[model samples]
Target: MSALILVVDDEPDVAELFRQQFRKELRASRFDMEFAQSAPEALERVGAAEAARLILILSDVNMPGMSGIELLPRARKARPDVPVIMITAYRDSETRPKAIEAGAAGLFTKPIDFPELRGEIGRRLDAATGPQ
Candidate 1:
């Protein structure tokens, strides 16, 4: 079965960006992606069969409600094994520590580098699934 990635971002375009960047992997059935515009919505998607296939969650830190940092624990509650990476344009240094404390596996600053992100995803997935 193909692995799944749940991407949560308040900016609608970010979802498209991830989809486009991962197109090659998606086409190869190496990964499948899903989008959620908010934390609550992302939490809801993290269950059942989808949860089992989900290898990673890429989430933006800033949002209208329940910021990514706040949503971290809740997401863990639903799917404890799934790794979450925080993506944001904000430069506040404090955010990183908070995200780590809240259970984020990594924090990535934006204008995201898709290649780097993809590399990290691949590494994490390999670690999770044992070398594809």
Candidate 2:
């Protein structure tokens, strides 16, 4: 089964960007990406039955209602095994620590480095699958 990744960002264009960046993986059926425009929407996805396939969550730090940091614990509470990576335009010291404290597995600065992000995702997925 393809590993599911939920991406939460208020910007509508972010979904297309992720699709472009991970096109090869998607074509290869390695990852299945889903988008949520808001934190509440993401939470609903997390609680849904399909969440069993969810392996990772990528979320923007700033949003209309709930920030990604605020969503971390709630998401974790729903699925403790899923790792969350925060994406933000602001890579300030405060932001990183706060995200970590709130239970984010990692943080990616805006103008995301897709190669680095890809490597991290591969590593995490490998760790999750274990000796496949």
Candidate 3:
């Protein structure tokens, strides 16, 4: 079975970019992509999809309500086994330390390197669900 990956970002366009970047794998059902526009929405999706095997969560740091840093602990409470990686344009000393403290699996600065992102996702997915 393919791994489900929820991407939490306020930007609506990011979902499209992810879909485009992983189009081949998506079409082949190697990975399933889900999107959430806010931290609340991400939590809701995560809660609702309890039966689904989610391998990773890619979250944006900045948002109108409940930034990724704020949401990390809550997310971990909900899905402790799943890795939550922060993806944001802001990469400063302040936010980095906060994210690390909040237990982010990794922090990725935008514009992200799609190849590296894909590789990490693939590895995580494999680790979570075994070979596709």
Clashing pairs in 3: none
C-alpha TM-score for every candidate? 0.94, 0.94, 0.95
Ranking by lDDT: 2, 3, 1
Worst 10 residues of 3 by lDDT: 46-55
* Alpha carbon lDDT at 92, candidate 3: 80
Tens-digit lDDT track for model 3 on 1-132? Answer: 568999999999999999999999899999899999999999999888755578799999999889899899999999889889998897687887788889999989999999999889889977987776
Task: Report every candidate's CA lDDT.
Answer: 0.87, 0.90, 0.89
Instruction: For each of the candidates, give the backbone clash count.
Output: 0, 0, 0
Instruction: Give, for candidate 1, the lowest lDDT window spanning 10 residues.
Output: 43-52
Q: Where does candidate 2 have its weakest 10-residue lDDT segment?
A: 123-132
Q: Which parts of model 3 have CA positions greater than 4 angstroms off?
A: none
lDDT of 3 at 125: 77
Candidate 1 residues lying further than 4 Å off, grouped into runs, are none
Residue lDDT tens for model 2, 1-119: 77789999999999999999999989998879999999999999999836557889999999988988889999999999899999999957899999899999999998999999999
